[model samples]
Target: MPQANWFPRFRLFLLGVLCVVPSSSLFAQEQPGQFVLTPGVVVDRSANRIFVVEPSDALATVALQSNTGEVLWKNESATRPLSISAGHSLMSLGSVDANRLGVLVLDGDTGKVRAESPLNIPPEAATLAAPLGEGRLDATAVIRGQRGLLRWNYTPPVTKQGLPPGTLSGLPNAELIPEVAQPQPALNDNPGGFVEIDLETGEQSVVDPAAAPNFAPANDAPEQPLLPEIPGPKYLSADGRHVMARERTKGESHRFMMLVFDKQSGEAIGKFPSNVSYVPFYVDEGRIVLQKEEFAEAIDGQLVKQPRQLQALDLNSGEVIWRQPIAEMKFRGPPPP
Candidate 1:
C-alpha cells in the first residue's frame, strides 16, 4: 500500500484544491519590475484584485491590482488565507498575533479589516504560526473558512503526568528493563487537529486535521475525448465552465505539470509543467498565473529553483504576459525571510 502524503504533499493529494479561471477580459499577469507573488495567491476577478500572503516570516497579506500589479494595501492582520468569501468581495483568514487570537476577514479590494472574531485557540495556533525552517512552505494548519465558520490548527500546551506503577515493576530483573527511544517527529510535517470556531458565535469545536480540504467542484462537466488529465488537486474556474489541475509528466525532474480543460466542451486549452509543488493558483479573465522555474545561466546549470519565478500565461491566446523571480520581486513590507 502507498503511504499517505502529509500536509503540503498531503494537501496536494486532495485533488479537489481547485481555482476558477476567468472566461473573459484578460489582463496583464503583473506589471514588469513590480510586485512579486508566491503560492497561496488568490485572485478576486469581480474586483479585479490579486491577493498574496508572504509564506515566510513577516506573514503579511498584500493586495494588488490584477492588471497593473499596483499595491493597494498590505497588513498582518490575516496570516494565512483560507478562502475568498461573500462573492470574492471578502477573504477569510486565520489570524494570530501578539495580542489578537481568532478568525480574520479582509476586504478583497482594499486589504482593510472587515471583521475580526476571537478564536478559542491561541495566537500561536496552527502550523502557520509554527516556526518555519530554513526553507519550508507547507502550512499544515487545517485552515478553512466558510459560511461564518472557521477551522485552524494549534499546538496544545503539553501536560506532564507520572506513569502508574507497572504490575511488573516488582518482577525479577524489571530494574534491568530497556528504555525504548521515542520517535521524534519532523517539523512542518504534522498538521495536528483543527479548532473549528463560529465567526458569529464564540462556539468552538475540534475537527480532524489529518486530511486536506476537498474544494474540488462538482465533476458535472461531460468528459471530453481530450480533456486534460488531472491526476492531482483540480481547480475549477470561477464561472464553473473551466477546470485546471496538475498532471504528472516525463522530461523533467519535477514530474507534475499543469493542465486546463473546458469543462463544457472537454477541450484542452492549456497543458504544461511548472512549479509542480502544491502551491495555490488562481485563474481570472482568461489568464492563469503560476510559478515558473527560472535559470541564472542557461549553459552553466544556473536554474533559480530555490525561489522560482511567477509567470502569467494567457489561456485564451497562449501568451505569457509576465514572469519574475520571487526572491527578486519588490514589495512594500518587511523583506520575505
Candidate 2:
C-alpha cells in the first residue's frame, strides 16, 4: 500500500470536500486539458502510481499513472473496477463482468497482471471485506440471504535466488473479522454472536453474544429515536486489542461520546467527550490520527468550507497529545443566499 500517512490524509481531504462542496464548484477549479477524475480512483503513493477507472459509452477504462501525473499503462480489458487493494508490492483489482467476479493482481510498479482469480456468485452479492495480508487474500461476500468468507494464499513469483523483490517484502499479516449477524430471537435480543472461520484449517466456530467483548445491553428507551448505526468502530488499536466506539447522547444536546473497550473481553476501559464525529486517519506505532470536520462556512460562490481541526491521541493514555486548527484560505466566494 502507499505510505499510510499520505493515503489517509488524501482520502480525508477528498471525503471532506465531497461532503461539503457542491459538484459544480468542485470541478470548477480544474485546469483546461486536465483529465477529470471519475468516481473510482485509488492512489498507491508508496508505489508512486494512481489507478483510475474511466467510465465511457461501453466498457470502462482502467489506467495507471505516476505520482507526477504521468501515464504508465492503460488496461482496457477489464470491466468496471470496483475496488483496489495493495500489499507486498502488489495491487489487486476487483472487477466484474456479466455474472462473474474477477480479481486481477498487478505488479505495483509495472502495472502488469501477476495473477488472476475469477469467482461466480449471485449478481446481488456484494463484497463485505477484502483485505490483503501476509501474501494472502481474505474476503467476505454477502447476498440477500447468505454470506461467506474466503481466504486465498498467494505465492508471488520469485527470482532464481528464491528471494522476492524489494517491493514484495515486508508485508504484514492479515487480520480477518467476520460480520455479526442480526441477533436471533432465541438469543434474547443480543445480536453479538458471529461466526469465526479459520482460514488455514477450514474450521468454523461460533462466538456467543454473551462472550463477545464490547457487547452492551440495548438502550431501552422507546420514545427516543435510535441514531443511525455505523458499520464499525471509529478507531481500532494497531494490535486490534482495543476499539473506540461512538454513541450519540439522547435529548436536545445531541452530543456524542467516545468509549474504548477491550476487543475480546468487551469491557469498557476509557471514555471521553467529543464535539464532532471522527474517523481514524492513521494508526501505527502507538499513535492515532483522528480526522473530524468541525463546521463548514458556505461562501456564496466559493467552494464549501474545509475542515478546521486535527488531533493526535495517544493509544495508551487516550489523551490528546496535540490539537491544531487547519489554516483557511484567504480567497472567499460569494456569501450564501
Candidate 3:
C-alpha cells in the first residue's frame, strides 16, 4: 500500500478552517458607518487611524476614523478627494476642482489645514501620487491628457533631528535612540520619468528616465538567477524596499501566487499561494493587509453567502500572521429602496 499524502491534505484542511473560523477576536471591534472604502484609502497604523474618501455627488468628504471604527473628523470641500498620503504629523490631500488641480496639507492630529497650493498641470490629469516617508510631502501627478508628470515639494514641520516632531513624540521610547539620517532610495527603475517642481522656489526641471540608477546586483555577490516573468499588477511598498505582485502558475490557470521581491536588487524574496481575487488594502510595519472573498451556495437558489476575509501577511517571511472573517469590515452601500 502506498503512503497517504497527509501533509498536503492537512494544509488544505487548515486553510478551510482559517476561512470558516468565526471566533477570531480581531473582529470584536465596533463597525464603522456605511462608507464605501475606495481604492485611495490610506491607513496610518502608528496613529491608529484610517482615512477614507467618501464621494457623494459633486463634492467628496475625507473622513478619519480610529482603528476600531470611531469617526475622528471629516473634511469636506468643493474638490473631490483624489488621493491622500500621511507621514509624521502631516497628511497631504490631492484634489480636483472642475479643471483646477489642488493640493492641501493638513495637520495629521487635528485635520486642520496647514497649507494649500495649486499645481500647474492640465485639468484632465486624474492620477495623484504623494509622499510616503516620514516628514516628506513631495507629490506627483500623471497628466493623462498631455502625457507628462507633475511633481511638487512641500516643507513639512520638522524638529531638531530633521524629522517631524509628531513622529518622535509618538514613539514610546524616544529618548533611548540617537538621531540619524533617513535612508535614501536609489532612483526608481520605472520607465516613466517625471517633471520636478520646487514649491518654494517656483523652479521646474525635467528628469530623464535613462538617467535613473540601475539596481543590478554587485559583481562581488554570487550570481542569482532571475525569476520567471510574472504577468499581473504590481504593488510597491511605501518605503520602496519591497514589491509584491500576483502571478499565475504555469500550466494551471486557477493557481495564483503572490511573489515578493527586493526593490533594491530586484531579487525574488518569497512566494505564496493566494486567493484568485483579493484587494491589497495597506502595507505597514512589515505586514500587508488584504481583503479576500469566498462564496458559498445557499439552499435558497437566489441567495449566495459571500464571506469577506481579512488577512495579514508578513512581508519578509511570506507567513500569514492572522486570517479572520471580517464581514463587518466589508464596504456597504445605502440600503435598497
Ranking by TM-score: 1, 3, 2
lDDT for residue 298 in candidate 3, whole number 0-100:
40
Every candidate's CA RMSD? 12.1, 23.7, 25.9
Ten-residue region with minimum lDDT total, candidate 1: 16-25
Candidate 2 structure quality by residue, lDDT tens digits, 157-211: 1112323334333545422432334422121121112333332222435546454
Which pairs, if any, clash in model 3?
none
Sorted by lDDT, highest first, which candidate order results? 1, 3, 2
- Runs in model 3 deviating more than 4 A are 1-39, 78-99, 121-275, 283-288, 291-337
Q: Please, what are the lDDT tens digits per residue for candidate 3 over residues 1-337?
A: 1112222222122111111111111112122111112223344555665554332332333444433344577665312222223242222333424233355545545666555555553211111111111122223332121122333343322222347656777788988877767543322221223453333222446766465222121121122333335455565543234566766677652467777777567776666666463344445465665555564434555657655544567767766676544322121222232
- Model 3 residue 221 lDDT? 15
Q: Which is the leading candidate under TM-score? A: 1
- lDDT for 71 in candidate 3 is 56
TM-score of 1: 0.50
